[model samples]
Target: MALPRTAPSSWMQSLDLPSQLFETGSTDYELYEEDDEFVLSVELPGFDPEEITASWDDGVLDIAAEHDDQQRGERRTYHRRFRFPKSVADEEITAEYTNGILEVRLPVEEAVVSGREIEIES
Candidate 1:
């Protein structure tokens, strides 16, 4: 999902209104699993690395940023959360911000599937 510079009201979102009404500066992001790890990359321009914060808690990944432009008397904030289907090695999670992009790597724990495949009868 893309992150907007500012989000619409929760009530508006719950109503399922047209997204055009909520249009704003968009921050592109991608999430995928590769080589037993989940990788997430987000585009966040005009923000310094010191202003961004990433946190992982209880299977959820939270990314947030705040920029206060004292000269322009403007403030920008961003926040998003993601959850993984499989267990993640939170302790080993790592993130890096460079060139207006933030990337997070989450190591997925080994999973054991123990269900037999069902036979379909025509």
Candidate 2:
């Protein structure tokens, strides 16, 4: 007999609300996975590499930046909020910015696996 399929969890359904409320920036990102590390690339336009800041607290990565003087003037204005998950701890991540892009490298922790089998007696 085939097992029954279950519906998606409530947490998955809740995500749709926030996505409708906030629009992501024009920037894009790519994640690369290697044997030992994960590399994250974020594209940031109209920002100087020196002005960008990135931090990882708990398990969420935070990236923010201000436009350079050449791009900012009295007529310019912006209002937006970007919320990150709480899993990213501040001490577990490092980042760098270059060429109007921010790159974050996160090292994956090794998992410990035990090779053992147990039989349950009814």
Candidate 3:
């Protein structure tokens, strides 16, 4: 006889490897709001420093990393996109990775007008 399925007691508790610790399509991360900055922490195991990259455009933050073992014929990748708050300085965002963890610091700044009035030529 088959046992009935039961709901998980926790949001992030599971027996599966890797998947239990992070989402399937992207890496796992935690967001924190501080008095001066917004912190974003991401877990990227088995990735090298050169393989990682980060960028921001139009208030959207994008992070990605990839590694390949040619002899082992294995490839691993992580990609995540975060829409930063309008109150934060998207252009000033910075990131650092250590011990398989990536921490991004985004200092909040007053919103400034990025547009300027243009004069039309006759």
Query: Any runs in candidate 3 off by more than 4 Å, and if so which?
Result: 1-27, 111-122
Q: List the residue pairs that clash in candidate 2.
A: 57-88, 57-89, 57-90, 58-87, 58-88, 58-89, 59-87, 59-88, 59-89, 60-88
Which digits, one per residue and each the tens of the lDDT, describe model 2 over residues 18-64? 55334444336777765566678787756666666765545656676
Q: Which of the numbered candidates is closest to the native, going by highest TM-score?
A: 1
lDDT of 3 by residue, 14-38 (tens): 5555554554455379988887898
Error of 1 at 10 (Å): 20
Candidate 1, lDDT over the whole model: 0.89
TM-scores for every predicted model: 0.71, 0.52, 0.67
| Model 1: per-residue Cα lDDT over 1-122, one tens digit each | 76655555654677788976665565479999999999999998999999999998899999999999999999999899998889998889999999999999999987878899999999
The candidate maximizing lDDT is: 1
TM-score of 2: 0.52
Select the stronger candidate by lDDT from 2 and 3: 3
TM-score of model number 1: 0.71
